[model samples]
Target: MRKALALAATLGTLAMTRALMRDRHVPLPTALPGRRETLSAPQVGTVAYYASPEGSGRPILLIHSINAAASAYETRPLYLHYRENRPVYALDLPGFGFSDRSRRRYTPRLMADAIHAVAAEIRARHGGETIDAIALSLSCSYLAKACLARPADYATIGLISPTGFDGRLSGEGPPDGHRGREILRDVLDRPLIGPLLFSGLASKVSIRFFLEKTFGATKIDEGLLDYAYATAHQPGAEHAPYCFIAGHLFPTDSTLLYDRLKLPVWMVHGQRGDFVDYRLAPRFAERPNWRIDSLPTGALPQFERLRAVTDCYDGFLASIRPSSPRG
Candidate 1:
């Protein structure tokens, strides 16, 4: 009788596990208020973005961070705030959002090129107007790479709660060298355990847990939470997250890339959260082209202190005189 009870319990647990692992085909709602469009980028196909190109002056390009449930919603505050002041555009990077989530190694180059493609499209539409690009969290590196590759395409760039200042990553390796562990990457790509692993990570509770760490507070934006959960449940949602966890999404020489940037840069970071290490930032802060500001809220400060974030960023932009797009 005891053995039968043990067998019954084992079967029940397996049944529950199977149920959780089942992929739910759900409609992914747009993260912002605008018409969604796509760009056929090389290497990374069908990049989706939200556009409100009605406002005047130079266009602004927004990029969101990378993680399990990341999307344009990560930049929603900045997008919505800037839409009325100027033309605002937000992109979904290679793996996470409405972009290509196929089974492939999502690299930093692929992500950066997606930014470039979108910027090129924007320039084509607005008489080759130079853009002011801004990004959040880990995305700072990719935007920096894009800016470095095509400095003339951008007027200035903004980074909020960016990665690369942390002591653990030196980011001084050879070109395109990633911090991904081969063994771990292979393990994550395995058949049997891979799906189950991603299922657990993409769970609503799991996303909220990580988001809380990022916000550095118990209270987080509920809309973001809902969108994150829904997007995470969509088809091919787990592909990019596996690469992210295995560290394939990050390049080894991230800091070196930032140090090489010559364009006017605005960086705003939070004092409270899982990512707050700007010790190396003083090096750039001493330079005339860099402006670093610290906020009281967590990593995504725009949500908690939107006015402060916008004001600081606006001040930075106002400081830079407008230049001819082709000059």
Candidate 2:
């Protein structure tokens, strides 16, 4: 019995040592390559955003997905192309990027509220009562909710590779209550381990591996890998992934809110996107006001096919007009 007990203890120690070693060598991304801007709003956490001052028209608010590599920088291709025609505002959602990280729980409601607060600030600065909002992946849920909560505040809504469309609506219980809730709580409560795991999932090597398997293309832009790595390693970035995995960074069922929304709604998704589910199109199509744009590219359509995505966005914007004149 003593010999068996000693062997088990030795194996446990070895396993722990291996985990610690792997963590120490984990490669993280650097800060996003761009100018950092801060926006302060009442009732919402201080928002960190990236902008290109070289554009015109009603400023467009771009919300990236909640992931380690997710940020306004991830949307750089779109921002660079669209900035000349419209001032682009890409924000690092509350707990991501350089934004506040003190909060322990992030929810779609909280994120939507943050978007509302940021919109208020943008209206104050740009003299516009309403703005065009674009969201990618997980961010789509939060932005959708924000638009639903106050339909008149947003002139148009854009969704890229959106989630939360499992033939359900917003406020519905998440699928796999036990597993999802446990994952959420584990991510939020265990900060250090959560970030490490999330970052590892988003690592360049991991991204490349997944891209090859999903897209059947191994030739990823080296610069993209570098950017992703650097952004994941930023000082507070370690906590951003945890918030995202916890599902507190974005709401899960904003699609159900679609029925109540009256704004021009456009959704774009890559057929081969990582988060793609057959249910997304059919679910959103059930709504009369929503329009869908399917891309032949991958989940990171902006990076995979920049010009095609830009052209699609430009055409969409041209087809719609602000419901009301800006102040």
Candidate 3:
């Protein structure tokens, strides 16, 4: 009888596992705010974005962070705030959000090119006017690269909780040398287990856990979690996230770009969160073009202190004197 009981327990566990795996394989599309449009990026196929062109002068583009379940919704708080006063656009980077997430190797260069393509589309609509661009976390590197390549395309720049500047090895390795590449490659290329591993990482519970850690608070935004879970379950969502987890998204020369930037750069970060290490920021503290603000919240401070975030950013923009083309 005891032996039979053990057999029954093992079967029950296996059945539960199968049920969870089936659920992960099922796709679910998240309901995102704003009118969604697709840009034909030469390198990244179809890149999706949410645009609001109401009250406008120079447009503002908001780029969300890169992670296992990144989306335009991550910029919801800031997007809604900016759209009320200026033309605002939020991009769902390729391989994330509503963009094309077909199985492929996601790279930082691909992501940077997507930003450039989106900016070009915005410029065409706005009569070649340079727009203001902002990015969060790792996407900061991509935005920096984009601005560097096309300095004439951006009016001002904002970076929130940007990676690199940790005074440590957060972003010091060679751009091509990712320590976790071999492990991630095996995890993503192995038969059967590849999908299973992605499923485990993108499960609703796993996403929630990550958000809680990001917020560094028990009271994380529920709406963000709901959308994150939905987007994470979409078809091919794991492709980019696998690259991100393997540390392939960070650029090696991030600090060099930040130091060399001549346009007005506003950087706002927080004191609490898994990403609060800007000890090296003082190196550029006195730069005439760089404005740094430190807050008392987590990585996503805009979620809790929307007004503060916008006020500081807009203030920085207002202080900049419009100048001619640098090139």
Per-residue lDDT over 221-266 for candidate 2, one digit per residue giving the tens place of the 0 to 100 score? 5666666565555555555556555545544345555545677777
lDDT tens readout by residue for model 1, 174-224 = 876777776887897876467788788878899899889989999999888
Best by lDDT: 1
Better-scoring candidate (TM-score), 2 or 3: 3
Worst 10 residues of 2 by lDDT: 171-180
Clashing pairs in 1: 171-253
The alpha-carbon lDDT assigned to residue 105 of candidate 1 equals: 86
Order of models, best TM-score first: 1, 3, 2
lDDT of each: 0.86, 0.66, 0.81
- TM per candidate comes to 0.92, 0.78, 0.89
Winning candidate number (TM-score): 1
Q: Write the number of the candidate with greater lDDT, choosing between 2 and 3.
A: 3
Hey, what RMSD does candidate 3 come out at? Answer: 4.0
- Candidate 2 is scored at a TM of 0.78
